[model samples]
Target: MPDKPAGMRFKVRNENKNALGGLATRKQITIYFTQAVDAPSMEVLLYLPNHVSGPVPAFAGLNFSGNQSVHPDKGIFMSDRWINNNQKGIQRNRATEASRGSQASRWPVETLLKNGFALVTAYYGDLEPDHADGWQTGIRTSLQQELNLAPDQWGAIGAWAWGMSRIMDYLETEKRINSKQVALTGLSRIGKAAVWAGANDARFALVVSNESGEGGAALARRNYGETIAQLNRSFPHWFSPAYKNYNQAPDKLPVDQHQLLALIAPRPLYVCSAAEDQWADPQGEFLSAVHAGPVYQLYGKTGLGTAQMPAIEKPVGETIGYHIRTGKHDINLYDWQQHLAFAQKHFRKKAKPKT
Candidate 1:
């Protein structure tokens, strides 16, 4: 969105994948920016389904921690970058052995590979650490003045969303990956980034926002939970400075979250929320999806179609899907199950045919 990266190239991939027991392969791909030659390069942790033949669709997401934290595979490279000190297994802002697979439950790797899908993820810290001053060590400060905005320009969310596009750039070049079926996904703040990425880039075939509150799928006009004012006060660096202008007056804003969802249009979009995560306003998110249905109808596609939120754990919709699961605000296996089903239905993707 803030102009494509100068260039993106992978350093290493598909090496030593046999160790995964033939079921799958994990490779670490480092992406370097030609424009910001000196900034820290982003690392992509990719898992290709060896069980599938030919190119396969993939899910590219930005993780909360380092790649090593996603899975316990000892082969996964530990991030050498700075991370939130409070994160489990992170010692002195660096990931350690104990950090491996700490968040594995959040990712259903085995199930995904069995279903014939590839998973691509990188630590959000790769582009810029999730802190106020993170720009100094990220591509944000390394890039030209245009990218590093003052008050009205894209901020961390914009940069991270741009990174998702860059990942798509690399995916387009890989024969083993079906670039046309790729889905961009994220949870919480990262989920917000995923939605924004989908709005700005059309390369992504699908998008998933898991409890991406406020600036995400949740309707800002409702002002039900996680109001705009609170979001800005808590995480000032997450959105464009221009967004803050309406922090206290969401109704005054010309557009709302539904417009953002509409941007994905006839393309498949899934909005998820949790019953207990009131801070994300599950109801508001459902309404946004409901309102976005008209836009989808313009293309002869379906949306949530209902003003009422579905029963907890009951997901509903076609082109635009939504669900409020019975849990707190976190991406779990259930969330993946819904998104996978949504992607499979919209993309017409099925398990790889038996040889």
Candidate 2:
């Protein structure tokens, strides 16, 4: 694969380290997004499982509701986003009725910890909601006036991916983590962020796109279930104004999702889909992965191991990992299992390792 972009090749420094206990050697830092003001304080959540006797690989992702909703842990700050939850966003001073435990089955924290991997997450709503004027409350609010973002710079998708990099800024300080071994992963809309984050940040060792449809892992040109037009129409703030011009006009898109996958190249990337999730276009996702293989070949790393989609629950593991499980549109134990197995295989303990 071609060398990573110069801006993404982050260099490490020695002082970026801290210790919690003798065995729990790690660092934790919070990056404050002081620009946006529609809500209260919003921050990323991180747990360095590397606090064990040795350094460990990690998975970084975006949470849908809020950081506090991911786990019962009190340490995670409550989100300030206008979530659909009864207790928090709706119902005034209470979370939304339909929002409780919505994603518990998706994020298997205990299972992940037992497998010896660190898990870090952030709230996508903290960056920008899927609505118009979201840019007013996102990273775009902090952009330097001198360097105005082209029409594409400050969309909801771009804002969320920018939030992911801010999380990386904190990850670099945690000594317990093999910073270079961190894998970026997400689901649905956040899955799109993960793909963009990995494409933009080379320090992220692996990129996993789980049901990221439309502009995500799916081939945009394929008239899929959730077409580009629907996304732009429903969530006009999600992409730049330039994106709307090509609604239902996939052929005119400067880049398809396959090229987005190619942006990751030699790095490990896992594209997951669900058998029943026709709305997300599973076949389109698989084909995009297949097309990106030529770029991976540049660095002697094979991309997807096959051209045809595999049987349900049949995972194709190679430099590129893929599996279409028998389920609806959501993450589950099966997805986590595949990700852990893949991480262990590629990010195993290095010989005479040095962090």
lDDT of each: 0.85, 0.72
Model 2: weakest 10-residue lDDT segment is 1-10
The parts of candidate 2 lying over 4 Å away from their true place are 1-29, 33-41, 85-102, 144-152, 349-355
Best by lDDT: 1
Per-residue accuracy of model 1 over 1-355 as CA lDDT, tens digit each: 7765545456775455564678788878888876345645788888999978999989889887799888888889888899998988998898989999998988888778878989989898888788887777676777645354543355788778888988888898878899999999999999999999999898899999999998999999999989999998988888777889998889999999999999998889999999999999998888888998999999998787667778888888878898889889999888888888888887786643221
lDDT of 2 by residue, 1-355 (tens): 1221122222222111232222222222335433334222236565554335566678888887776666654344556566544333345433443444446677776666556677777677766655576567555564424225543555778778877876777677766677888889999988987898889888899999999988899998997789999988888877778888898688888889999999998899999999999989999999999999989988998888789889999999699999999989999888888887787778874232111
How big is the positional error of residue 241 in model 1, measured in Å on the Cα after superposition? 1.7
**Local distance difference test, candidate 1:** 0.85
Worst 10 residues of 1 by lDDT: 144-153
Q: Cα deviation of 346 in candidate 2 (Å)?
A: 0.9
What are the TM-scores, per candidate, against the unseen true structure? 0.95, 0.84
TM-score of 1: 0.95
Q: Which is the leading candidate under TM-score?
A: 1
